[model samples]
Target: MRLRLKGARVVDPGSIDDYKDIIIFDGMIEAVIDPSSPYPPVMLDSSDPSSVTKGLKSEENDTNYSEAGKIGVDNFPVEEGDTNYSEKGKVEASPTVSGEGYTNCSKEADITEIDLAGMVVVPGLIDMHVHLREPGQEYKETIETGLKAAARGGFTAVCPMPNTNPVNDNAQITAFMVNRAKSLGGTRLYPVGAITRGLKGENLAEYGDMKQAGIVAITDDGRPVENARVMRRAMEYARGLGIPVISHAEDLSLAGDGSMNEGIVATRLGIKGIPNAAESTVVMRDIALAELTGARLHIAHVSCEESVDAIRQGKKRGVNVTAETAPHYFTITDEAVAEYDTNAKMNPPLRTEQDRLAVIEGLSDGTLDIIATDHAPHSLLEKDVEFDRAAFGIVGLETALGLSLQLVNNGSLTFDELIEKMSKKPAALLNINNDIVPGNPADLTIIDPDAFWSVNPETFFSKGRNTPFAGYHLRGEVYMTMVQGTIAYHRTDGGQ
Candidate 1:
């Protein structure tokens, strides 16, 4: 099948940024064509509905295409006098060849064309951190539900943590996850294997076996590897296998059963608090380990000013360390917990206003490499409890982009930088290619930058509805997401 996505602004970070047409064939991008090139003629059969050009517009409209069979660039009838000429936008009656921006499709071939006049096309977003509770904890989320939510959120791929009930510690569990996601068929899933067996922080898992079974990275996500020696061995082993060791950087003793950030908010509420040192101290240790072992280390969900500075300084010393932070860390502060809102609670809990600013600065200055959603889903049984007893996370996959777009809106990062952090950088880290180039998989996201919508958890595709941003208005929406040349999700109501 041949698909021509016409007249959309193609924003593929450093590669391309212009109004162009994308040609997709058989689940791959066949070509990126400049709309200004007039070599390929618009071929259309007025009698055939499917062959009619889509996105028709008057000459007053600057857009070059039309909706399904009217006068437009891809398919317009060339009349005798009023507007038809050979040198102009007229197509040859029967040209059977291909040119710079044109392909002559045979009558037997099926061609589907969509006119995306005002949309922006980018590489599909990838979330390096998400929790899809399958294999054991299906009540909270399944592979189907989590993948659907990721697709609707414009993520083409997601890396699920290995914190399932049984934990993905071996080849059997890793293969089960990979096969399940493949069978479901939507957003791609790359499982991150457990670093320590059972996340116990003692015995290291079989990195070679898990990597063979298809784990992209290794991490003891929900539980930190408390033993420095164990973590160092894990990093060294992962380095030999050429996979990054993702760290859940938190000192359990320092965190000490805290429910939220250790600050005035927790103090006033009389709740247990987790101080900044709880996370930064571990982060510093991991960086030192990475430096000593010559291993790639990625710090997950960095939430404080001290951790950001640590990572920045590590990079300065030429340490092989990379880090990520979630949107909630920068968008909101510990103050969101002022009313004892359990939904606002998360591990390495939201920090102070100063910490939030530091995170934004880290991202702007390239200290942080990726913006991943630690999309943990929980049932009401875990979330409806008291503040200190509530679950430590909120469903983030659906709200990540909307919240992260605030950075661009506030001039904290450029549009290109945001796309790089969300799509390009993550793909590079995971060793996947999601660029909008010919021969690459047609995994793309179409966005409506001005589309305004309220954060309604009821409308979310994820099973979990726990969110701190519910009812908050956000701009920039995922208009449609395409994976492997197939439309996985399309926003129905357009915009709220």
Candidate 2:
């Protein structure tokens, strides 16, 4: 099958950024042509729902992706970077991002065309720290629903934590998740294997075997490896396997019985608070360990200012360290919990406004490498409880991109930089190649940076309704998400 996307401003962050016509065939980027080129003629059979050019779009609305039919072999000039690529000499990326964006149907089929005029087409977003509860806790979220949420959010690939019901600590659970994602068939789901067997923090999980079984990075997320010796062993083992060790970076003992950040609000509410030290201490320890073991250490859900400082110092010291922060860390603070909203609750709890700004600064200065959602999902039973009794997370997949774009709109990051953090940086971290160029996977995202949309959890694709930004008006919207060259999610409205 062949497809052409016309009239869109192509943005691939660290790669290519310009107006281009994209041609895709057999799930790979066949070509990236000039936007001024005349589009191959296409016809719409209005009577047939599946006809080419059929789309839920507004007339000339400026970004609807309609189907195109016809494969005209033309001499299109390709971008130099599109043709040039460094070989994959790096270690395997964490199970991350999408196809060069294609899925073949029939070679003889007519070309499908999608017009993306006035919209921004970028490399598909990749969230390296998403929680997909399956093989045990399906009520909160399932593999199917989680990936749907990701696709709806413009993310084509996500790395789900291994702290599931069965704990993806072994090959069996790892294989189960890989096959389950294959069965669900939407955005790509990569499993992060647990670092400790059952995440007990005592024994190390089989990193070598788990790597072979489709696990990407090894992590003991949802819980910290309190035992330094055990964690060191896990790192050494993963280093040998050549995969990253993603640390949850929290001192449970220090964070004991705490519900929100240790701040004025917590003092006023008379609720126990978690101090910044809890996260920073672990980050400090992990960085030292990474230097000691010579392994790549990636800190997950970094929320406080001190942790970012520690991570920055780690990088300065030449430790092989990378860190990620969620949208909530930079967008919302513990003040959100003043209303006792469980949706604002999360592990490594939301910190003070000072910390929030620090997170944005971290992104701006490159102290932070990625913007992951840490997209933990919880059910009503878990979130509807009292703030102190509620679960330690809220669903995030649906809001990460819109909220992050807020950073762009405010000039905190350039459009290219935001796409870099959301798509390219995460892909490189996971070792997935999703360059939006010829001979690459056509995995891509079409975004309307100015599209105003209100958040509504009731309409969310994820089973989890736990969110604090439910009624927040967001600046951008995901027009369409394509993975492995297949249309995965399109805005119901024609991206006119």
* Best of the candidates, lDDT: 1
Candidate 2, 34-127: lDDT as tens digits: 5533233222333542333222222332222211111122234422443211111011111232212222222333467788887899988999
TM-scores vs. true structure, each candidate: 0.88, 0.86
Q: Any runs in candidate 2 off by more than 4 Å, and if so which?
A: 38-110, 494-496
Clashes of each: 11, 28
- Per-residue accuracy of model 1 over 1-496 as CA lDDT, tens digit each: 7888988999999878888788888899876766543213344454543322222211333223222112333323334462433323233222332232222344323457778888899999999999999989899999999999999899999999999979999999999999998998889999999999999988999999999999999999999999999998999899999999999999999999899999898899999999999999999999999999999999999999999999999999999989999999999999999888888989989999999999999999999999999999998999998999998988998888888887998899999999999999999988999988878999999988888889999888898988899998998888889999999988886563
Instruction: Tell me how far the alpha carbon of residue 171 in candidate 2 is from the true structure, in angstroms, after superposition.
Output: 0.8
> In candidate 2, how many Å is residue 168 off?
0.3
